[model samples]
Target: MGDRWQVEVDRGVCIGSGMCVNHAPAGFTLDSARQSHPREPETDANEPLLTAAEGCPVEAITITLLTTGEAVFPPEE
Candidate 1:
């Protein structure tokens, strides 16, 4: 099986920048309030998805290895 990731967006941190949606339209969506949400919380580890998480200005998006809960973005220090 391919790598799977658990995606999360912290609405409190999100600034409604829409950067995540621009980076990965298939992986994320913006609500009427402009909060970003993962189309599927558990999804394949795709380039665009990673880009979206990295592109987030506030680092609101987080990606983790679904099976192990290892941080994939804003990697643990």
Candidate 2:
């Protein structure tokens, strides 16, 4: 666990598309609700995680740099 990044899933915004799971199964899973959820919020920063977040059709996944408190995914406004 590098603990440098914070990954989150917005269940309300998730469309249950399973793209995140397909991209990064170790970090994301589709719960019984069929929504994507984080299994390891502070896992080592990786490319798949970013890809998973970016690939979300609904942009439900959010990845933030813990050190800087800056969102790396979903392109924060």
Candidate 3:
């Protein structure tokens, strides 16, 4: 219903900790076979994808707003 946000995971940096999945199950899922390979779904740009990015222990997830070109980085806190 709104502009979709995209999520990308850098497997080279991911540790398969499952934090992203736990924090935002609707947006991210684990590959299981290759646990570090995170599968992210299309999400509403207004949703909380940034929260999930921050939840990743390895900071592997990146959230990009398709409409505005705005990107959210993981919070330091």
Q: lDDT per residue, candidate 1, 1-77, as tens digits?
A: 89999999999999999998899999989999999999999998999999999889899999999999999998999
Model 3, range 16-64, lDDT digits (tens) per residue? 8877777767667778554544354456664446777877777888776
Off by over 4 Å in 1: none
TM match of model 1 to true structure: 0.97
Between which residue pairs do clashes occur in model 3?
A: none
How many residue pairs collide in each prediction?
0, 0, 0
Residue 54, candidate 3: Cα error in Å is: 0.6
Model 1 worst lDDT window (10 residues): 49-58
Q: Write the per-residue lDDT of candidate 2 for residues 9-75, one digit (tens) a residue.
A: 9899899999999998888988888988888887778999999999999899999998887878877
Deviating ranges (above 4 Å) for candidate 2: 1-3
Worst 10-residue stretch by lDDT in candidate 2? 1-10
Model 2 lDDT, residue 23, Cα: 93
User: What lDDT, from 0 to 1, does candidate 1 have?
Assistant: 0.94
Better of 1 and 2 by TM-score: 1
> Could you tell me how far off, in angstroms, the CA of residue 56 lies in candidate 1 after the best superposition?
0.5
Write out the backbone clash pairs for model 2: none
